[model samples]
Target: MLVSNVYRPMVFGCRADEPLVEVARWMVDNEVGALAVIDGELVTGIITERDLVGALATSDDPASQQAAAYASTQIRTAELEEDAREVARRMLDAGIRHLPVQDRGRVVGMVSMRDLLALETWTA
Candidate 1:
């Protein structure tokens, strides 16, 4: 199945200037591990629970840290029409749990590692 068939539509996102604390709050509220960082409808990067943890680990004041500090380098992404297994492999090789799904230059969804695993079991 293609990524669009199984990708999660409930995208969690943040802007560059959004504080880390706010990012953490959104993650908590959404019960998700990551958030896509968007700049005017384009996905610029992603921030994850691990990113927050890493920032906290490196700094004494995570609460004061900016979301941009923990935001990941721009990632390789998949189109919603790409195969699910292909996207899963890309995420696995990159050591990331989330893949932002873009359509015509705009993010439309996300596929998490858990979502892929779930798909595997369902198909099996």
Candidate 2:
């Protein structure tokens, strides 16, 4: 199956300069695992729940105001044309739940492990 079959366009997103606290709060409020980090018209990075928890775990204060310090700038992405199985495999192998889907260098949609699992033939 193709990613477009299950892609969600209404997913959460944030700018690179957005405060990490805002990102964290968006994840909590939306009950999602990650948010796509947008850089102008490009999909730059992704900040996941795991990233947040990891940052908090190593930090002396979880609620400190240094939000930007906790957000992750490194990200992995997949093309909208890629097969769903490939996306799922990447997510599983990386132990991540979110994959930012880009189309022609623009942020298009996001795919979650949950979305993949709900598919009829997701193996990862």
Candidate 3:
């Protein structure tokens, strides 16, 4: 199965300058674990729940921080036609839970561990 087969449609994201509080609220409202950090049309980084927690724990004024401060600049992306199993393996090896799904250099969706595990159940 391709990533397109299992990935969730409509990538969730926040601007790099978005406040940490806003990012946290967005995650809660969207029911997502991570978000792509976009600067205009570019996907600059990825911010996960772990990042948020770490930032909150370390920062005296968490509200003053932005997504760019906590988001991981090194992000792994998955092609729409890439094998889903391989994507899962990549996530495992990278110690990441989410990957932005891209098509022709444009982000279209995101695939998470939950999606991959659900696929496992179906394919098994």
Candidate 4:
């Protein structure tokens, strides 16, 4: 299966400078575990639930920090046409749960480990 077939088309995101609290709220409201941190039109980083939790635990004022501070700047991406299995392998190697799906350098969607696991169960 291709990443485009399994990835969620809705890419929830926020600006890099946005407050962690606001980003967390957006994640909660959207019921998403990860969010793409954007610098203008470019995807600068990715912030996940784990990152938020870590920030909350370590920071005295989590709300004062920006999403960029907690986000993983070295984003590991999966192309839209890439095989789902390949994407899963990349995610595993990178030790990440989520990946932004790109098509011709533009972010089109997001794929998570959960999504890949669901695909495995469905195929089985």
- Overall lDDT per candidate, in order of appearance: 0.85, 0.75, 0.94, 0.93
TM-score of 1: 0.93
TM-score of each: 0.93, 0.79, 0.97, 0.95
| Candidate of highest lDDT | 3
Q: Looking at model 3, how many pairs of residues clash?
A: 0
Task: Give a tens-digit lDDT track for model 2, residues 1-124.
Answer: 8888887876477877776677788878988888877767665667778777777779776665343455556677778788888899988898878887778766677889888888845544
lDDT of 2: 0.75
Better of 2 and 4 by lDDT: 4
Model 3: per-residue Cα lDDT over 73-101, one tens digit each: 99889999999999999999989999999
lDDT of 4 by residue, 14-68 (tens): 9999999999999999889999999988889999999999999999999899999
Q: What are the clashing pairs of model 1?
A: none
Name model 4 segments beyond 4 Å from true. Answer: none
Best by TM-score: 3
* Cα RMSD for predicted model 2: 2.8
